[model samples]
Target chain A: MQEKELIPYLYRTEFRKITAVLCRLFGIEHITIAEDIVGDTFLLAAETWGLKGIPANPAAWLYVVAKNKARDFLKRNTIFNEKVSPEVQYSAGESHEIEVDLSPTNINDSQLQMMFAICYPGIPPESQIGLSLRILCSFSIDEIADAFLTNKETINKRLYRAKEKLKQDKVKIEMPSGSEISDRIETVLTTLYLLFNEGYYSASRNTVLTKDLCLEAMRLTHMLTENKNTDKPEVNALLALMCFHASRFEARIDKNGELILYEDQDISLWNKELIKQGECYLNRAAKGDLISRYHLEAAIAYWHTAERDSPEKWEKVLSLYNRLLMVEYSPIAALNRTYALAKVYGNKAAIIEAEKLGLDHSHLYHILLGELYATVDTQKAIRHFTAASKLTKTSADRNVIRKKIDKLKK
Target chain B: MKEFVMVYRSELMGEIKLTAEGNMVVSKEWENWMGGIAAQNKLVSPGMRLGNEGRVIKPGNVVTNGPYAEIKEIIGGLSIFKADSIEEATEWAKTCPILNAGGNVEIRDIIQVNG
Candidate 1:
């Protein structure tokens, strides 16, 4: 089949799932080799599929090829005796030999286990992220470095150290049981969220990496939602939150990659498909009695996306922020909530509320205050803008604030 | 696990490269490098940074200031990494930006009591 036609069927999602299963079946010591075998299967497919036209079942063909490769590799290693014979592995569409569950139930659990192993507490965070991207997302060390705005050498060192740590700790490939699984799930979700943020707020030339992180998060969440054991309300809520926020990606920035405040962005550019998915996930997330931060955040983002002209939506956003603040006292969330309050109420009331908080140390908070004061108090706005310009490190941000300050003088 | 302190030293004290807009580029780069390291969770707890008043203490007395050794030899800041062996620890030290600034990473095994 044409490469374009096969693109949809052949994805990192399948690659990660198959590789994780093989790695679990074999051992952690052979993870690199297992990944190599998986890569070779894809390479073979790329060459032969175009000539033969993709088989009616491409995943099965790739799986057969990969399984054979794994057996051959294990045969060479001597540590693991090859289990499956190449001939018996592929027997029509149905086979009892491959007991592995590629369904959401099985795949989600395996992927979550793999994610936790990569982000293991003992491993350095840099290595955690780099190894996760390389092992699970198929990102090269150079690509990971570029995503984090660092050199490839740094990424290489981190990956090596992370792998060594896992080896030394004798970390198993299987998922932890009971309460440990819950803790591991939290870490795994957090790692994925951080990965998304890196891509979203990345100071890179192309903002596409951010969207890639969002898609990866969604894919992982789907894996969780599919699994019977792992399909908790929080997992679905997290997916809903990501979908709602990601739906606005197109309107978040222009072709030049400059920041567009949420208010100034074009609502028409939102993705309807993603919005619909977000609503479905949100409904599923609400099935449980307990509310999660993700549930609240998704509800807030839905409110914004669902109604473009509703000025009262800003109040709902603030309320959601307040609820989120109760769950987690993050300074960033507080700063954001204060800004929304400034928009809803007058600047004086908002400024008084903001002054009571310790957010005066944040450059972003000062900028928001400056923006609130631009019309009423020019000199105070100028002072705050100057303070923010001095506090901010990004030249792009400084330029915008300086322009604003210059305009206020007129 | 072996702990290695990769000290990032600098020669210029307050000499910053200021842009036409009065932005300090060197300090910005320094902050970016530090932020990158911090992002990776390499920063150890109870970390202390020495400023202009830092002094070298000897067995008998404390030296204030004088024609100290080369300015590049002055320890600025340190990043800690845990590795299985000294060699593995040294490998991590090689990536520190201090080496690019004409400074060397001093590798010493951290002494600990087993009790």
Candidate 2:
């Protein structure tokens, strides 16, 4: 397989977890040095494994290479040159029998800690994710900029300023306690959710599917599960939510790279294993009495994945949305739920509910309302489709809306 | 082993906007400027940014309102270069973004006190 095709299989989430752990153990300062070693290690794996057949333990092989490389770097830079103070104990002659546990840092145990350390509630939430992506995920400054759809210079300034604040506040890599963890969890979850959406949205054209983003969120959620002190009911709910949504990754896009709406998607193409995993996570979440927005969203996705996955179950989906609305009211989510209601109940009800949504800023809500109007009230629908067509910036989307207008007129 | 500093300021206002094609151009320019110097291990650091509006503190307890001199003629970013002479530093700065916009290059010498 080409490197692009093999990337999803080779450097999976497990490798990222291992990398995170290794980075934490060896110190964040050694991140670049360690990453260089890891990069070379992957290159060697591509050459060796591609020819000699896959190794029994690929991650272990990569881990060993990373550790050895780290040791070599420390020897050359710190021990031999004495660049760092000699007090730093990087002794060369350690016992060969002893094994080093170069596991990646578990965000599960330390996500709250990492969050509080990075997110002081003073800096904007966008900047918090900017720092997290850098410090936690080890993304390059340019990579974060691409993710944010902004220039590298803007991202660089945000990261520099964020790091300065972290230094000024003297934030440590440890878990937060009590109410602080709860508050910080919001930022951490929001960042992860946004990260997942960016991946799901798959903004970059060449990379139609960024499994890395999904894997990153799953790895972070796994960290939450592992950390005894940091694990919360909401974390479990989020994990379930991610798993349920991720189950449909294969069916989300067509072979031609066109967007496949959920109603038209091939249900059989959904990953049953991921659905099973999501179920397990949902069960784990049920242990706690506290219900979260993740739980509600996951429940709705579970319903869609459960049976026929037809438009028939729109009522059930609407009920789940109502439940979600009770927990946290989002205009976007409400718009989605209203669409479901329109399908099950009728167009008039959907239009009435959607009109009250106050989503004047969103082009999508207008489009959805227009589509509904086309069926029940053609004149009103034409007006809406025209308004929506005018409101959108993307010519591609507007072209679709124009087609819809033509169909409605005919 | 004297280090020379080459400060590159964008001559055009909002002209440094990098499109996909522009990025390809700028990245190539960046590589030629930095990598050419880095081959000799003399490129200390390369930094670039447009102008920002902030208070400029001057001597005699004076504060200037804005990016100082001219908005169009503001300094974007600079590189603290480690080269043999001002000629080499000027040569390096010659390949800067300004050449594309018909702008000039400024090269400064670093004075050592201890040596």
Candidate that scores best on DockQ: 1
Point out the worst 10-residue segment of candidate 2 chain A by lDDT. A79-88
Task: Give the per-residue lDDT digits (tens) of candidate 1, residues A57-85.
Answer: 88888877887786666546655434333
Looking at model 2, the pairs that clash are A20-A104, A20-A105, A21-A103, A21-A104, A21-A105, A108-A223, A108-A224
Candidate 1: list runs displaced more than 4 Å.
Answer: A1-14, A40-62, A81-109, A124-126, A178-180, A306-311, B1-115
Task: Give the alpha carbon lDDT tens digit for every residue of A141-244 in model 2.
Answer: 66667776679999988866765665566555556676667777776787777777777765554343356566676777767776675578778888888998
TM-score of predicted chain A against the true chain A, for each candidate: 0.83, 0.75
Please report the TM-score between candidate 2 and the true structure. Answer: 0.61
Summarize candidate 2's per-residue lDDT along B1-115 as a digit string, tens digits: 6777666665445534554433312443454335334433455665455455556788899888766464556665676677767776776676676668666667887787895
* Chain A TM-score of candidate 2 vs. true chain A: 0.75
TM-score for each model: 0.67, 0.61
Pairs in clash, predicted candidate 1? A1-A53, A1-A54, A105-A227, A199-A210
Chain B TM-score list for all models:
0.57, 0.67
- lDDT: which candidate is best? 1
What residue runs in model 2 are displaced by over 4 Å at the alpha carbon? A1-123, A131-143, A178-180, A307-312, B1-115
